[model samples]
Target chain A: MPAPAPIDPRGPRFNQAVLSVALLTGFLVDWRPVVPLFALVLLAGAALGPKYGPFLVFYAKVIRPRLAPPAEMEDPRPPRFAAAVGVVFLTAGALAFAAGHAGLGWALALMVAALAGLSAATGICVGCEIYLVLARRRPVAG
Target chain B: MFMARGVIVIVILFAIALAGRLYRAWRARLQDEKPIHPLVPDSLRAGADRTWVVFTSPYCATCGPVEASLRASDPGARVVKVDATREPHLAESFSIRSAPTVLLADVEGNVTARLVGAQAVDDYVRRPPSGVAG
Candidate 1:
């Protein structure tokens, strides 16, 4: 298989910082619109890659130009994997809230928020780490 | 009451996230002190006096610097770069859950020390714990 594309390490983390705030606000307000919007953000990131992701678009077009080039470029797979994880949580939360399971929905949303906030604040991508572990354990195809 | 609950929840979420980060950092540091004798893949076995096995992934930005530092620090030791994505089994054998994880091992493939994340070359060159015979 071909090697994955390289990305500025800051791009995903910046997107996560913005996402954490949106998620936190969505949970605190119990705002239904916030859920779908946040889910859309994660969906774009996971399916389309960071260049096409909304928050990352902002980072690439606006923030990245102002800063010096990154000392190193990273693989895009891990952050994309992280975005996939976010989509799972966000979709589940949104559905739960729509179904009137407010408590469960909020719980799931809070988990996403916490994980995003952790990555934003500390640059520790737990979802990415989990992906690595699972990928290693998966059986290789012939 | 509702406002207070929201505030409490937010605070709790942040606190939990921070705690998890701290715990992982602490654990990574602790893992460095002991020799876990991680398994080495055939491709990585260099048959050298000391081998620097670097576990890296495509998404690891800091990995390049770590590899460079290790190579610069010990010209004598063999440095092997393993792509965690392509060689997941290698990562699993070493119990590597994160990128840029460096394992210092002996000729017999016994891990002497493990370093996670970015560090100076000196950090990697430091002598391993005496308890485990290399």
Candidate 2:
């Protein structure tokens, strides 16, 4: 298989920073509107590549140009996995809110926000880390 | 009241993020100094002066630079790249919780030093394992 293109390590973190804010707002205020927006952003990122994701589009078009080139590029898989994980959480959160389970919705949103905030602040991709750990634990196929 | 709740939630999230960062930093530092715990599998043992046993996954994007860095640092050394996804046992046995983890071992397969991220490649090369004459 052909190798995947490497990406600026900062791009995903930048996307996460934007996501953290949206998620925080959703959790703290009215989650009804924000849930769908969050879910759309995350699902787009997960289904498409990070470059195509809304937040990353902003990062690429605006934020990236203002900053110096990345020190190194990385494979897109981990962050894509992270985006997928975000989709799962946000989807569930949205559903909970729609179902009138406010507490559950808030908890899920909080989890996503916390994970995103960690990545944004420390560049520590917790969802990606979780994906790695799970991939490492799955039984190998013959 | 709603604003206060929001602020409290944000504060809690910040605290959690901070704690996670600190824990990761501590683990990375601790692993760098510690030898490979005895639990690592025998297959990882290498018969080389300084073998670079790198643990990577197909999903980890950072592994490319890490592999490149290891090769550049010690062109002559044998760099063994293990796909943690295929060899999950290796990760479990080594207690490898993250990707791009590199273990430097001596000719006898005794792990000399551990590195837990792509960013630590320079440190590993700069401080080559002890007892090997430069």
Candidate with top DockQ is 2
Candidate 2 lDDT: 0.75
Off by more than 4 A, model 2: A1-3, A139-142, B17-21, B28-32, B36-50, B62-76, B85-98, B103-106, B110-116, B119-134
Where does the lowest 10-residue lDDT sum fall in candidate 1 chain A?
A133-142
Candidate 1 lDDT for residue A96? 91
Q: Docking category for candidate 2? A: acceptable
Per-residue lDDT of model 2, residues A22-110, tens digit only: 87776666655786687798888779777668888888888899999876577777788898888888889888888999888877877
**Docking verdict class for candidate 1:** acceptable
True contacts kept of each: 0.31, 0.51
For candidate 1, lDDT tens digit of each residue in B7-35? 85669666867777787888778666554
Best by lDDT: 1
Candidate 2 residue pairs that clash = A75-B61
Off by over 4 Å in 1: A139-142, B24-28, B31-53, B57-134
B3-70 per-residue lDDT for model 2 (tens digits)? 88678676967686778779788877865754446523346554456678899877666787788888
